[model samples]
Target: MCQWLASNPNELHLVNRMDEVGSSKSVNFDGARKMALKQIEEFLLSFSDPHIFSEAATSSAPATLAQVVEAVRIPEAGNLICSAAAIGKYVSMLQNPSSLLRACAAFAFVQFTLPGGQHAMHHAGLLQNAGASPVLRASAEAATARIESKMYARIVLRNLEHLQSSPSTQF
Candidate 1:
């Protein structure tokens, strides 16, 4: 219980739910846990850059990791959940605190959705430059009038539209 509270200072109010041995039943801590999760989710959404994640996935990386990372983006949903979940997984995979700090530092330059926030089109950032086959890239550029357009850019645009209209979004 103390450990949880220490890790989640905002959840300190729920400490009373702990057992006499200072251990809380999972069910008893549900609310606090949920709140902590929501907070983490919100924080990640506001801090992490999906653009970096997507770009890294598509770069010349190992196939196995690329496959998993490519699928990290949410389907039919534009909310920040996908980015948050990916960032959480990324944080878990790091072996050193410096890596986490570096990631956080890099995120400082990316805008996001939040009060007084400026990132109105999060998808735009992710699609800034998309690598794709020459043929597909030519096709998209032909249609969009943007000569440099790529297939990844087109797909990202289409996906963004779908996500915007998705009814599951809360923000």
Candidate 2:
């Protein structure tokens, strides 16, 4: 059920229902684990090569909305060119639970801003997260703010207000 939804573009319109479905407790833990493992395997093979991740991110060529979503789903591309020291630093930071949350938030910011700015028209697609911390959610919102503002000042202002008052998370 979840796999079909995840892979289907039509399911995006049924987001509310999808959320309800995802939030329901799973009755089959082993089945869920097996499914997750299968998806990961498929996701890995779906890419032409993992090395392309960093190349795609740093490339100046404009990316479509679909490409941006692909980048966010698999951030291993960002790490491809990062130095060993940088990787160690990230690993060390992830060791702390709080820092991990903050890192996720920061990652969300980079994901939205870089893709839309560096790439183009990449804002058409929405961010997707099955479960993310409050800080991470806020970070994505902030990134969204930065992106929309680049397109429209009025929207930027309105979103700023919306972001300040609302604590809810988007998909």
Candidate 3:
């Protein structure tokens, strides 16, 4: 059920809208926002189980990672990335052996480093941990190259190379 909703673009759009409306001061949309938030929270709670990926029978890790990436990609949903529970889940997934999971985690970091993502930056240290994978490095490099914001690109690049020698990261 969660996977189906996460994979649906239409549902994603509505979720994004709900986030925006929920944060606004308009009283008229309060009920709508609350309902939407409840649904989103329920979906997020699905990740609370540490073995969600391994236990799921229908969804592959990559697909689940993609769902996480999509959630983070939504501008209004940035709060989700900073949530302690969510961050723990993401960091755990980041360390997974699957290259796809690592890549998606890196993409989520990139999204978090962009404008209006200051809250999410608290988890930036996870990217520099000793377990950083080559796939993550590649994803960070690609994200740095593709981002239009110079400041954000530089920040992402710096995080990716924080501990590594400068010469090793040269283009």
lDDT of each: 0.32, 0.32, 0.42
The per-prediction tally of clashing pairs is: 0, 0, 0
TM for every model, in the order presented, reads 0.24, 0.24, 0.32
- How good is model 2 by TM-score? 0.24
Q: Candidate 1 regions off by >4 Å?
A: 1-27, 60-171
* Alpha-carbon deviation at 117 in model 3, angstroms: 1.9
Candidate 1's displacement at residue 103, Å, is: 10
| Best first by lDDT, ranked | 3, 1, 2
lDDT of 1 by residue, 1-171 (tens): 223212332232223233222454334555664564465445435423455545643453445333422433322222332233333332232211222222221122121212122332443323222221232334334433221122233343344444456565333
lDDT, candidate 3, 21-94, per-residue tens: 76685635657745755664454344333343233223434455344333335464345335444444444534
Model 2 per-residue lDDT tens digits across residues 22-85: 5685533455534544553453344323354444434534343234345444343222232233
Model 3 TM-score, 2 decimals: 0.32
Q: Which residue runs of candidate 3 sit more than 4 Å off their true CA positions?
A: 1-73, 125-155, 158-171
